[model samples]
Target: MFSAPQHAVAVACLTSVIAVAPVPMRSAFAQSQFTDVSSNWAQPFIDTLAQKNIISGFPDGSFRPDQPVTRAQFAAIVRQAFKSPATRLSRPFKDVSYAYWASPAIDYAYTTGFLSGYTNGSFQPDQEIPKVQALVAIASGLKIQPVGSVDSTLLRFYDAAQIPNYAKPGVAAATQRNIPVNYPNAATLNPNQQATRADIAAYIYQALVSQGRLAPIGSNFPASQYIVQGGSLPATPSEAGTGTLAVGTELPVQLEGAEPGANLVMTVGENVETTFVVAEDVVNTRQQVVIPEGSKIVGRFQPFEVNKTLGTQFTASKLMIGNTPYTVNASSVPIAARKKSSLSIADLTGSITTLAASAALDSAISGNVRFGSLVPGIIQTGQTIGKQVIGKSDTSDEVILVEPDLMGLKLNADFEFLPGSTTAFVDPNSANLYQVDSGTKVDLAAQTDNARYVMVPGETVPVELKTGRSIYNRQNEVLVPEGSLIRGQIVPMTVNGKEGAQFVANEIVIGTQTYPITAASAGISPSSLQSLSPADFQGNVIASPEASQSLRGVSSTGEQQSGGLLGLGSLIGGSGSGKKVILFNPTSVQMEFRAPLSLNNFNN
Candidate 1:
């Protein structure tokens, strides 16, 4: 939906070009002007910003990323990058006249709190801006105020002493805002270095991320690696708290679907996963967010302290913030506080509650349930049994019956995200089972037999691995020896009753692991099968690619002989016709796992 606007790059602040290579699939320039920066550590930043229309590159196809940015140029860029309303009256700068090309830009930046003038009653617009100065400008404009002591956070930088006193707070705020992009070495702030195109691009990109306009780049990227941490974040009375929640902090939550007048009601006792959405952001005294609105709280319904009222407790086990989840000790007051429902537990869980759920839910909700069709697909969440128990992003919200003001979910213990919480969190299964990334090339075989195997449409046939393979990482180091004994099935499809066949794959197996795979082979028209006349080999075995066929002649020993199995097969095609036309198999098959298949402990 985004259209890239053509822009010309100029040199200096006015020059719009900055080149940052991408992490692939990321490019805006038809021919990259940042070609010189393919090896420049900041290309990811450049790629992101330039693509977002925040930066431009030279017309001659060069982005001098290392080029120093003058104060005036920075002001110009800032004026165009940040969207903010003016907060103060504009005043004349002694050094810049109204007619100066950068004059309006300087005033806009100054009014937006992104730039300031020297005390000598002059805006030295042409002076080269320093690293700290630029970061401060962005932090101030976005109204980010750091929490705790700025000095302590700044100490993480090796050049702590070199930071100008006035710029310290701004730099600290920027750090907490995650705006500093130090390359090669994270500890080196280089605060006094003249701001460069690359540096500014990274800062602006990071600022956007803090505002949630841009998703945070993963920590593995070079540009993301230098993002300074250890800075005290603000307990913004404007945003929430210190992005922390206290032991007793209560988050305002409601069953996700409770709209204006009606409440989502659920029958409890079945400990299926129930989800709650933060009704509003939970903020601290300073108004910094502890839990943001729309975050998920996955919980379970448990017996309420063994109460006879059948009031169940929703025990919060995990808090999903952004893409990460944290275990929490929290529980809500009784939801189904007064229900001994006539509905059976089977009435709630799906097949685990499908048909019955829809009827029972409607009956329970409005005293009657609707049945659009006795078949399937019309089964919907809140309407269908199996789906109503869990809260999904695409599904409508579900809430347990509870008083609006009384539904307080209280945290039993202090919850805080530690430094590098997101980055340090590892997938428990990252190294589990050796992984052959998607698109891994595999060689396989189907057992050859004397029996002529003929499969009609929708029929399945087994296939197996033929050779061993090794998988390697990007570093070319062997990740795992090729897993062996891979197995799966080949499915046959009639080519539109055209006397042709296309044998597509349904799944492939590796070792003892079964993975769902999808595949389709090129159509094999009858013309391709014209070579096979029944008289030539009445007793000879014939089958589709899934079954060992004549394309690879089988030896008398019954072992699959070597040859191209895809070269027009002798089996497949059934239209209630006992009369067999020379069997045809598709010429080729393309397959990939529906989900990534990673398994280990195999005999190669």
Candidate 2:
């Protein structure tokens, strides 16, 4: 696999004839010429290759470290790095014509087993190659063989599920040969990310070192250690440095000096920044210290849309533990108004009674009913209505406020720490600190009766979790407890000529933390007979002889009316009868959780 420096020089000379004029060709003497690569992690590898004439920089004296490396550019590098004779006959690729700039390099790479065209008989030479694909190609070209189990070796650098099927063998072989060079974090091998020009330089140089063609650099860089023989996997960022806290790591904190009714006002569509100190030392299941006590957690309330009915919803967007910024996918937290009040059933009944009494007086003046009898009946109906209203309004009259104090709020997700000496790298996959399964059940009580009045679409109402019940996972661990607050929105629906609202749960608030939850079941207890109708009022008014004759006259004419003026009185003047519409909350309500909730690292 090793090639003499003179061989690279010769290859560079040949390829320069067809090289792009914009990128100036560098001579073997012009090493470390790229200005942009001075501080790059791949600088050492780039300098070494440039000195050997195996790589060159652009005319502007820049390496363009992060620029993607196309397949054609990779082929040119392969031709200059490997001097072995072709083992197989070369065939023209459909996409690479004889006039193509890199056609010669492509043919040489294919015949020497460094690369292969796709099954479609086309070589997409201009396409950017993925990191794993580039690693596999270099390993194959150098005939590297795995010294250990392929599965186990690849798992050391990446999650098993992340390894692609086609690149498995090649990646395994590369790992054993110690030819893979990962910058930033050694443990994270971003297999599918596009390979950069800097990345290619590191891979080629490492391949050369593995074959004993180049001496390994005595550097403490993470990538350098992987190339040294028998070097222990570079210490995880945690062990080697001060340790970095991964994004999505939950930081449980307490409100330093907050009172029960403290108000935190946040406007919709604006960012609110705040800071809280860590309440306790947070450690993961791996015993890694993610955050230490007194550590500062910086956070900002992201811009959000306020639902006129649901109040203002705020979600945490920018969060930083120490100096590392995290992408937070947390649930929107609803802020409560400073002062709120609810209507009582007694109050509602009183208003209805006053209206009914006035209607009754009007009926008597219009000669619609006997004055003396109807007046006595109206008085009795009012007394009966008061008793029924009392039974329906058995709920607490307390107003609830939503105020989450972050000072002592425990983290709802795991906090993973991987510290480095100066800069820390976070594991992208580990950012999802909490996992909630599907089909979990949660029981809730309606805060306001959706059936109290005709509900309109887009209306938001409050609900609470019923007492004495807890939401549990399959392991019987409680996720949410009774008395938690939930917000529901009304979705208007009409069926069989009956119109009502379908309550959809938009969020659940536990303590100060809020999570989005879907409601699977919503039901309300049926109203009592007395609440549904003014039966006593109808009995007294319709049983009189005069009322009986009026009913018979309508009945004899085939109009089929009943209860005489009593039915008309109930329809026109009764507070509790005549097409009664129960639109808001019922006497009792139950709501079930539609999504699974996990409290893996949740603390009470």
lDDT of 1 by residue, 144-223 (tens): 67666788888889998999998888888777766788876889999899888888888887776565445556645556
Query: How many clashes in each candidate?
Result: 23, 21
List the global CA lDDT of all models.
0.52, 0.48
TM-score of each: 0.42, 0.34
lDDT: which candidate is best?
A: 1
> What is the model-wide C-alpha lDDT for candidate 2?
0.48
- Where does candidate 2 have its weakest 10-residue lDDT segment? 385-394
By TM-score, the best candidate is 1
TM-score (C-alpha) between model 2 and the true structure? 0.34
